[model samples]
Target: MMRMRRKVLCLDWDKRTVRLLVARVGSGRMTLEDAHAHRIPAEVNTDDPAALGGVIAAAMAAHRIRRRDVIVDVPRDKSVIARLPLPPTPIAELPDVVRFQAVKELPFPVEDAALDFVTLTADAERKTATEVLLAAVRKDVLGRIRETCAAAGLRPARIGLRPYANLVSVMHLPGMAERRVLFVDVGPALTEINVVHGGRLAFTRAANVSVPVLGDDDRWQSSRLVVVGGGGEQDAISGAIHDLVVEVVRSLQAYRATESNVVIDNVIVAGHTGVETELAQALEKRLALVTDLFDPTLPLGITGDRGAELRGFSAVLGLAWGLSTRGLLELDFLNPKRVVRRSETIIRRARLLGMAATAAAVGAAALTWSAYRAKAAELADVRKGMEDLRRVVRDARDLTNRSAEWDEWQYDAVWLDHLMILSRALPGPGREVIIRSLVCDSSSSSIRVDLIATNRERVKQFVDVLADLRAGGLPDEPQDSSRPKLYRVEQGSWVEGNTAEPGFSGSTQVMLRVVDVEEFHSPAAVNARKAERERFAREF
Candidate 1:
């Protein structure tokens, strides 16, 4: 048995910044491998697809990431989330029910929105109603995001809401699972309020709020008078924070008012902008609730500077953690058609490979039988010719000439040499390039290849490399009149609209003609090709 290792890349972005996190998930555990943060330009419109795409591309390049398994945390402002109670419905009919519910609940037309839902609680006996969290985003918004990520050479596996991500992050905190708690994540422009009861999210809301803009090194500090009570800019920011706390208090009261049996026992504050002792103390004093700075990474047994940055990455961490552990929340807005297309492509490839192998095996057996019959006939003729010395000598000369011509026609190393040339002509590590299919014509000595890449830049680079290879510019391939020639190049969309596979959306078609085989027949070239094949086989 072999253990499967899964690597997931999670991204969270807001108006100010985009954060990238990579984690290796296995055996019910997740390990954070890398983290990066890129600030958006003040002039760039975050809503513009082209602008955001460039930023995402630069961030991915800066982080040196090549993996495509990604989950993005969309801004809470762009999404609509609601908790709905519905009569017991069969699992198979839930999608239709959810879609119908979304049409009524969403502000926009159902056709213009992407909808998903998760059942939070259900009665086992199917006698009572079930509570479901329904999420919706406008199609235009989701389409723009999809296009932008595709341009950046990424196709996110899931698009998660920030509030749900935050809930997943703090739900496992000590005493949190057993008690009702309010998780307030204060961001730069918006504050997310999530209420967790019995380890499940009961309520969530996002309110516009402003907080102090502090740098990484700036510890939250205010003059004693300002901390106590003052009238200035710092005091104004404090006032804003206090107002946010008041909103949380109101939401808590409202939740308790409706559900009389539930009471929020604690308030947990977490986010990049407002995870300070001052804010927590203020909330505790004002709300008369036990308030704490929520750092969920502590429970994962992570420490040091990376763990310290967990406050800023609460949502992304939750996304990765939930994916690893298969948590209850599973909402993704990635187009279903695209997912189905990818699956179909994979299945098609597998079937094609199996068919090709079977055909090759059958052909080999037929060729062997034909060759044996030809050899038997030739032997009988040779024995007959042995009765006459002159006939035997004449037949032997004919046979020698025929064998020489056959040897010239069957250059065993031609295909191997062509493969080696292609391997050298393409981008290697750190480049998002995939050769989807390859075909060689023996009689014409031409190769046709289908390639897909992450972005246009990489595809252009591949073309340039092919041109160089054809010109024999590389060190290993010497210049000659009979060098390989580039015949045709075709570039097109690998995946159109939102139905494209991640990291494989840019498509290119290439044809190369191997004009000469004399070079590959040399002893040194044959030995080199043999050694390369051996090494490849060992690695495989």
Candidate 2:
């Protein structure tokens, strides 16, 4: 089927203004149709959905954007982003695995956040492992965005990260993917920095640095012509520029610390603060790297006086372009991809099969009735046998009363002693071994322990110590000398750690069976236990 042509409206906003871009996307092509920026009055509260949506709606109407569906962006500062190095895992299992790791690093609870991720290129040192870029936003934030959109009479088709969008627009340029580049998007209240390596986003951060917004008409003028209210405003602009440069340097340092071998080839400053030229010059001078202002119109072939204004629309343009070309974005919180567990699929299939079985059983009801008639005589005979068995059960109950006496003398599992034994088996605290959980089952006479260590060797060492304790008698007070083995290692295995930082550690779960050596040695107790086991086995 031929795909329908779509009119894409991309929207993003800051405290000061709401920016909108409209594009025609289809037929193997995407072209920018129009772009506009609507300023929000100082008195209006951006957090109020009704107030913000009115401004957004006005901007859309002025830009002639009739489409209600829009692709929105969540700024870097408004969301949480993390780079996680996970063990080798199948693509089908990535969603669960990513969530498992992301929750540990997220500032907010996973239950309250919307999550999405995209796999990045593997690290050279760990070729078999998968590296993922995880993104999360609080549900409250998304709820507000949806409310604002609803008030503006728009439906949010997808929500994307602004830093990634900026990176995407830059990567669209000729020969950009092959080179290591730093993308700096200077916004009114925040500046986002993204590092691209091997055509993938490697690092991203947002700094609190607000650029001074000059006149609406003179967006692309040089810094020399920027005349603010007074010298204080000018000093504030200069200070903000300096702070932005410092943040860029810090971001570069942070990225290098994580990836020591990477060398940034160039930097691209994008935004329409009118002082981008000066900011780019300052960055280039400070960082000693090639830095230039990002011009969006040149690549899209946008001519006329509007080219300068389009510079600020890089993120929105990228969001539109990516969604248009690719049916789905790599990371979209609105419709994040998730893996369906095999058990859930099986349950669905079982429901259908059950329906079929019910139909078959209904058809066999006549035969069942005939069989019931034939079994009537047999049922009477079984009832007579049950009466006879009842008498025998009465006799057994007398013997059970005697066995109950031995049960009182039987050695019960004392969890406190077992805990002490486990403590002795495990290494001391501050040894890089953390016991996440320890569950004791007195009925089963087993202790299950979950532990995480700094490395696989430590986990294995801990398991070996546990096994040794199971083989030898436990050390307890008063009876410590001749006490028989009180534990038997039933199950143990190590797995790659999902919570390990820097990814070279593992975790292990050990199941140990608790033994009452004293009870086993007592003949009466042994006989009683043996009888109970036999009875259980027979019943099962």
Provide the clashing-pair count of each candidate structure.
Answer: 0, 0
Give the alpha carbon lDDT tens digit for every residue of 58-133 in model 2.
7666556789888998999889998888888777778889889987999989999999988884555544448788
TM-score of 1: 0.57
Consecutive 10-residue window with the lowest summed lDDT within model 1: 218-227
Q: Where is model 2 more than 4 Å wrong at Cα? A: 1-4, 122-129, 216-232, 340-344, 347-540
RMSD (CA, Å), each prediction = 23.5, 27.6
After TM-score superposition, the amount by which residue 398's alpha carbon in candidate 1 deviates from its true location, in angstroms, is: 51
Using TM-score as the measure, the top candidate is 2
**Among all candidates shown, the one with the greatest lDDT:** 2
Against the hidden true structure, what lDDT does model 1 obtain?
Answer: 0.67
lDDT of 2 at 227: 28
- Residue 464 alpha-carbon offset, candidate 2, angstroms: 82
**Clashing residue pairs in candidate 2 (N, C-alpha, C atoms within 3 angstroms):** none
**Candidate 1, clashing residue pairs?**
none
Q: TM-score each candidate.
A: 0.57, 0.60
